[model samples]
Target: MSQAMRSEVAESWHRSAAAGVDVGAESSPITLPEDDLVEYRAAHALAPVYPLLDDALGEAARACDALLALSDHQGQLLWVTGTTQTLRRAEAIGFVEGASWDERLAGTNAPGTSLVLDRPTMVVGAEHYRESVRPWNCAAAPIHDPITGRILGVLDVTGGPDVASPQTMAMVRTAARLAESELTRLGGPIPVPHMIDGEVFVRADVTVQCLGRREAVLTVRGKAQVLSRRHSEILALLATSPRGLAGDELALLLYEGDVPATSTLRAEMNRLRGLLGEEVIGSRPYRLLVPVAGDWNLVRALLAAGDVVAAMRHYAGPVLPHSDAPGVVALRENLHGELRATIVASDQADLMAAWTRASWGADDYEVWTAQRDLLPATSPLQPLVRSQLARLDLEFA
Candidate 1:
C-alpha cells in the first residue's frame, strides 16, 4: 500500500528536508549530560506537571504499547516512559530524556513539528521526514504557559500506526491541556512586577513583533504612550546605543545628510520627554535612562548564543522599517544583512523554511534557492521550487 502525507505533514517534510536533514542517515542524538539533565529536571517550569501528565497518559500508553514523552519548548525531551519493549526501541532511536528533538535537529516528527505549529499534530509513516522514524507514528501537542500563552513544551504519544489516528491526537491534546491546567493550578497568581513606575517597555514594530510594522509603543510606570515617527526613531537609536549621542551626532544620524535644526530636535526631545516622564531619558548626550528591551536585541542575543532558531523566531522585520535616519538605517541594514547571511551560511533547511515564511524572506531569492538545493530531486516540492526559481530568474533578469 502506498502511503501519502497530508498537506500539513507534506509541508513539514519539505521544511525538514530543507533544514538539511538526512532522510536515510542516522545522526546520533545529542543528549544533555546526566548531571545537567538532573539540574534541568529540577529547574524546568514544567517539572511539576510531569506527575499529572504521567497519571493522565499512563494507562493509554500501556494499553497501546506507546511511549509518553515530554519535551521543553526547545524540543529537548525531558522525560520518556513506556512499556519495556517500547522503551528499548525508543532508546535505540535516541528518544531518551535530555535529547534534543527540535525539528532543526530531528527533522519532521511529532514533538518537533508540534512545537513549530503550536498545535496538535500527527506524523504518520513517511510523514516522519526521517526514514528511520517512519516505522512509527506519533501525535503531539504543545503546552503553553497559561498566563503568557507562550509554548512551554510538548506532550507526545509515540507507537506503531495505531497512535496516528485522530483519536490519538485528541488524546494528546487533552493530555497537554490537563498538563497546562495542572501548571496553572499549582503556579498560583501570575507574578506581576512590584513596581511599574520606573520600568519602561518599548515595543518597536521591528523589535516587538515579527510583522515588522513601522510603529512603536512606549510604556512607563504602567502608562502607555504611542510614539510619533520621529520619537520612535529617536528612542530606537537611544535604546540601541547606551553611550548616548551628542546633539550634532543625533541630528546627522536622524536625518542623514540633511540634519534637522538643533532647535527642532530639542523641541521634539522635550515633547518625547514630557510624554515618557523626565527620568526615562537622560540629557548628557541623548540616551535612555532605564534599560529597554526590544525584539531586535533579543534576536541579536539569540544569534550570538548560536540559537538561530530562536533568533529567527524573534526577528519579524528590519529594524525601524520606515526610518531613513542615517544611523538607524545603517543599524537596520547591518542587522538584517547579518541575519540573512547567517541563515544562508548555516544551510539548515528548517531555518531556511522558517525564514522564507517570514514577511522579510517571503520573496528572498537566496533563501529560496538554498531551500530548493537542499530538497531531494524526487520531492513533491520540486515543481513548486522550480516555479519559484523560474519567476526569480525572470524577475532578476
Candidate 2:
C-alpha cells in the first residue's frame, strides 16, 4: 500500500488484500462456461444497452487496441468487445466475457474496483493489486437504476497505457450515463446485488413498488417494468392478499361502490399477466405464483428488525398514495399509522427529527411533540423543535 497509490485504488488494494485473494493468480478466477455465459449475457441487466454500448465503444476500442467490457452489478463480465488482435491479447490474461473481475477474485482492477465503490475509477499500471494486471490500464464506471439508485452494472475500458488517459475515462463514464439514459426511456431491471465473501452477487426476486409514487415499478428476475394505475392497484391487492382473490373478490376491492363486471377484471388480469408472465399470476384463486417483495415489504421487515432508521429510509411514503381502491386505501392508512406510531414510540430524537422533516409530517403535531420530548434540554435543536410544535399548535387551533 504505497502512498503513491490514489486513495480509491489504495483502498481497493487494501480490500483485495484482506479478502484473501491470491495476489499471484494470473487470470480471473471466476469464469462462467461459454454456453451458460451466452444465455446469461442475453438476459443480463445490461442486455438492452449492449448494442448501444457496442456502437458507442466498439470502434473506439478497436482503434487503440482497447476493449470495452460490460459487467453485471456483481462484476461478472457480460460483453467484452475488441478487434482480433486486441481480443487475443486480452484473452492471454483472461479478460473476456463470462469472467468475474470483482476485486475479491481478481484483486484490484478497473471494473472490479468500480463495482466496489459504485463510482467511476481508474487503475494505471503497477497501481493494480495483482502483479499480472499491472501492465494494463483501465477505467470503469458503475451504471445504476434510474429511479431507485441501485447499481445495475459497470462499464469499463481495458487496454494499453492509453486507456489511462482522462479522455478514455470521460468516454467510458459518458457511455455509462448514456446507457442509464436509455434505461430511463425504456424500462430496465431493478437489480439487487449483495456481498458474500467480499464479492458482489445477485440473487433473483420479484419486486413490486407502489408506495409513495403514483405509478408502480414492478421488477422480476432483474427486469423492471412500470405499471398502470389499475395494474398497480391489482398488484397491491394481490400482494397483500396472499391466499389470493377470486374474480369477484378482486373486483370488489378494486371498485368503489359496485363490483365491476368479470369481463373488465378479466381483461385487466390478462394484461397484467402478459406484462408479468402468465405463470406469475395464477387462476382458480388468482394468486401470485412468485413471492414478490418491494419497498413496502422491506420497510415492514426493517421495522420488525428494529432498524427504524433503515425502515424509514425504505418507507418513501404511504403505499399507493393515489389509489382509491377499497383495499389500497385501507392499506395506505394502516401502513402510515404503523410508521407514525413507531416513530412516536421510539425515543430516538433523530427518528422523530426525520419524520417531522417529511412533507406529510411537517405539520404533524404529535411527532413534533415527541421529538421535543426526546431532545435534551440543552440541545441546540430545541428552539427549532419548539417553533415547529408551536406552529403545529396554531395550525391545529
Error of 2 at 63 (Å): 27
TM-score (C-alpha) between model 1 and the true structure: 0.68
lDDT of each: 0.75, 0.78
CA deviation > 4 Å runs, candidate 2: 1-203
Q: What does the lDDT come to for candidate 1?
A: 0.75
Model 2 superposed RMSD (Cα): 12.2
Mind giving the per-residue lDDT tens digits that candidate 2 earns over 32-123?
78887776666666778879988998789879989988887667888888888988887767788888897768888999888766689999
Which lDDT tens digits does candidate 1 get at residues 127-186? 777777878899999987654345678999999977978888888899898887776677
TM-scores for candidates 1 onward, in order: 0.68, 0.53
Clashes of each: 6, 1
